[model samples]
Target chain A: MARGSTRPTSRDVAQAAGVSQAAVSLVLGDKWRGRVSQATAERVREAARDLGYRPNLAARNLRLGRTRTVLLVVPALTTEFFAGVYTGAARIAAEHGFGVVLYPSPEGIGPARDPFASAQSALDGVIASSMAADALTAIRGEALPLVMLDSDPDGSLGAATVNLDIADGIRQAAEHLLSLGHRRFLHLAADVPSWTFEVRARELAARLDEVPGTTVRTARSPISIEGAVTAAQAALAAPGDRPTAVICDDDQLAAGTYKAARRLGLRIPDDLSVTGVDDLALATAMDPELTTVHLNAELFGERGMRALLAVLEGRAPESGDIPVRLVLRGSTARAG
Target chain B: MARGSTRPTSRDVAQAAGVSQAAVSLVLGDKWRGRVSQATAERVREAARDLGYRPNLAARNLRLGRTRTVLLVVPALTTEFFAGVYTGAARIAAEHGFGVVLYPSPEGIGPARDPFASAQSALDGVIASSMAADALTAIRGEALPLVMLDSDPDGSLGAATVNLDIADGIRQAAEHLLSLGHRRFLHLAADVPSWTFEVRARELAARLDEVPGTTVRTARSPISIEGAVTAAQAALAAPGDRPTAVICDDDQLAAGTYKAARRLGLRIPDDLSVTGVDDLALATAMDPELTTVHLNAELFGERGMRALLAVLEGRAPESGDIPVRLVLRGSTARAG
Candidate 1:
């Protein structure tokens, strides 16, 4: 019998079953079907179970030279959007007999050093969110095959890039609001400095520029409902015509805009129209469901994983932006 | 120069630098300070850099026999509360020279299998949320040191347990509503059959039973805003003696209750008062901010990691549950 907390080795199990260590390894690895007799395999299995012997993953990983694990480094995991991305990534990874380890970009978690060391997993490659650009330097320092999500393709460090057509999503949002006679617009932007958010800002500004009589005001808030409420409240507090339409960077910010409008007693549609990006769960939970862009978060994750897989296999990643659509909901109406 | 996508081995670097494999290993591993000249170490580093060589983590992990990595098995990563928990755990883990890899229990992601296999990181220990109890069986099948979060102390399978004072949080929520002269109560409980949610349901019933006039109605919802909306709407639709005070299992549920009330044309703190647990950002995003129990999620995580560290060192895990508090907000009012 195994004694104390020390884990029993396969050698111990082999000795207990009166078999060679090679026989024990073969039986446990399931490669002994032809080589070892049925009776000997049964004895080995029973002995292994009784002793609670687990094959050392460390040894297996070393022998295989590939852990088949990939690290996904995202800026944060605080939202359902990223959750969907993770879900999609994990699904595809599993299909390819690969595993994904998540590293939520160590913002407040700790020092931003080797994410691989932090993941504690030997990784085949990395699929990182460009929002976690700060960690990119550290990631680029290593020779791992990397795929950057929502990053500028031109500026990327030879790493494969996957992007949601965020600029197009913003264009659709601006056009929807503009067609609704929302001449004066408030762009409620996420304060995070990322290429994704930058694309939204740039596209919205350029799209609105083409429409005459459009005056776009901007308010920046850290991506939280309370932060949006405070920032939007202050932005809208100015006298005269408060922007009749608000375009939020994402749904969480849009939820905040809802609070801001409510606090000021501005009724939705009748007094203010709002639009947001990333049709998150919060978008629909509102009294008037949010009118927003539906970025396929799951597909985004899937494509990101596929790109990483392509990079790993020394194949040029299938490129071209993943399309996004503007979802029309109850939140927007003809500007009052 | 190394060719193709295959990673350059230490031998490649050694050959490139005109040195023995042992010399290359010593210099690259930073163990050649006294034995090898400074020029030799510089030559090795340059050769490694030129070849884009990265030391194989698999071999290093085997040699060390400790990955210094821990897995945090969470039910889901969509909630800000778990994000906080992760933040806290990672902070403590980094301080102890350990890394945390998250495995959001395979709900939609994949089949329930070895979390270590899913995490793809060889782990030193595991800190799992009891809410993800379904994954615990697979976890227990391995010999990894485990510290369960929010699991029942009495029913624990000889593993260290870390828990929040959920019962006390429920007691506080109920007492606050009762003190507001609320006789009829609604316990908006999480439909999940976890020890944490069970404690909320059990403690609320017992506490409400202590008051003569208090009649607590129960409603269960899958932990999402939409699920809560549908469940709360149906529960409130029933004719006579509708609950004036709705005490939700968590803030997200409370958000849904707010939507149901809005749909039913019932104003918060006027026709009804509401309370939620977890004090998520959604709490304040509502017009009338939620009055909910504040479970220090980060502290809970920190404690869980501390307990796991203790177990790994063969020390007794710290006993006692982490305390919780109820934050008073506008959503709750004196009975009309």
Candidate 2:
């Protein structure tokens, strides 16, 4: 019960139980079913319990040369979507008797930094979100089995990749607004320099270009509500005609547009229609529930971890983009 | 680079540099300045670079008996507030040459479980949120230096406790509503069984008892906005005179109240006014910005990690409740 002291060692437990250290290890490791007698095992267990002996993971990790732990490198944990990814990854890891360590990459777009210095846990592999691509080079240098999430498949440098079919989701959102007799559009995009945000811009442009007489104006901001509000208000306040519909890259951006609209004395759906991707809880929390695309965040995390496991086992990774769906809600309506 | 293969070892680097393995270790471990020749150190560095060698953290941890890593256990990672906590903890950990490993305790209130198995990182200590109290006993068994965040100080069982002044926050919120001439109150509380929520309920009750002719009703729900909407709507659907002011434990619950009011054809600040704690981005994102108490989540995290470091150093933790503030916004107005 002394503070700042290390946990009791197996040797201490062995001494307490009147057994050898090997017998204590064998019993504690659950490998003594046949090697050691049940009575001796029970004695070791009792002594371990009485002494509060906990195995030294550092020693075990050194002996095994593999920790059965994977580091999940993410751009930011504040994003609700990434939280879902962690949930899915952790659940699958637990099922496999493995552990997950989260590394929230330093903010902004830069070369991906190695997580080893910060995680401290020796990792067998890494499953990183594309938003944290800047750190990928450092990760690749470690020669760990790596899986990239939401990255470009063709451009990925031999790492296994998992992606949400985001292009299709953007198309659905653009087409939904286009079908509502809208031509003028505003795309409130996340400013992060990643393939995911790039896809949103490219796909939305291509889809809108196919419809003649359609004009799409764009504004960018960091993915925060305040950032969205400032960028959106400026874009909406620009000198010319205002777009009747706003297509946000994510739900947080959509929420910002709602606040901007209120500031301008405009009503959702009545004056301007809005659409967003990532149907986070904030989507429904909006006064008029958001019309947005639902990307399965947990599924994304699960797939990323699964692909990493496959790579570690020398098996081919499962390839295919996870499908996303569009949910119609109160935020979108016929364009005026 | 071969997939699923171990990283280059010191022996490999030594062979590449035409030096002994001991020389490589001496240079890489930063002991070469005094022992190894400058030429040999340069050779070892170049060889390590060519072979892409990373020091085996597991072996080093085993030898040193200190990993410089700490586990941060929270009830949930998806909450924006907790994300801020992680950021703050990481910042302080970095400054102290330490690492933080996050373990989001499994959902639902069960006996606080040990995170050692899932984190897989050899930790020097732990800083846990009170919301994850179920896992504390298991953590206590490890005899790691422990620091508790937003937990009951008197009940911490010798573990260091750091807390936000939530009682003062609740009091400010209640007194603000009272000053606005509102008597009937609806406490939309998080259903999670944690000392933090208990403090909100207890403090609110104690403060309201000081005022005459005040009626307070309570409703509980999971912290999600949808859950809040459902629970708030159900509670509001009851036939008796409804509470004119709703005080939520967090911003998400306040957002849900916005939706619930819309469902019942009640206008915010007109038919019903609302206030919340945890001034999350969701607070400003609401159509009528929420009136809520701002808890500096990053400060909370920084303080928690600092306490753990103190414990690790056998020093007494800095003791004081972190101050909170109330921001009056559009959600609450003079009661009509």
The candidate scoring highest on lDDT is: 2
Task: State the iRMSD of every prediction, in order shown.
Answer: 2.3, 2.9
TM-score of 1: 0.91
Per-model TM-score (chain A alone): 0.89, 0.92
lDDT of 1 by residue, A59-114 (tens): 88888888888989888877878888988999999999899888888767656767
Task: Tell me how each candidate scores on DockQ against the true complex.
Answer: 0.58, 0.58
Identify the leading candidate in terms of TM-score: 2
lDDT tens digits, residue span B163-262, model 1: 9998998898888888889999888889887899989888888888888877878888999998999999988887789989998999999989999999
For model 2, how does the per-residue alpha-carbon lDDT over B186-266 read when each residue is reduced to its tens digit? 999999988999999999999999999999999999888888988899888777888999999998888888898999999
The residue ranges of model 1 lying beyond 4 angstroms of the native Cα positions read A1-53, A239-241, B1-55
Give each model a TM-score: 0.91, 0.93
Per model, kept true contacts as a fraction are: 0.73, 0.74
Which 10 consecutive residues of model 2 chain B have the lowest summed lDDT?
A: B105-114
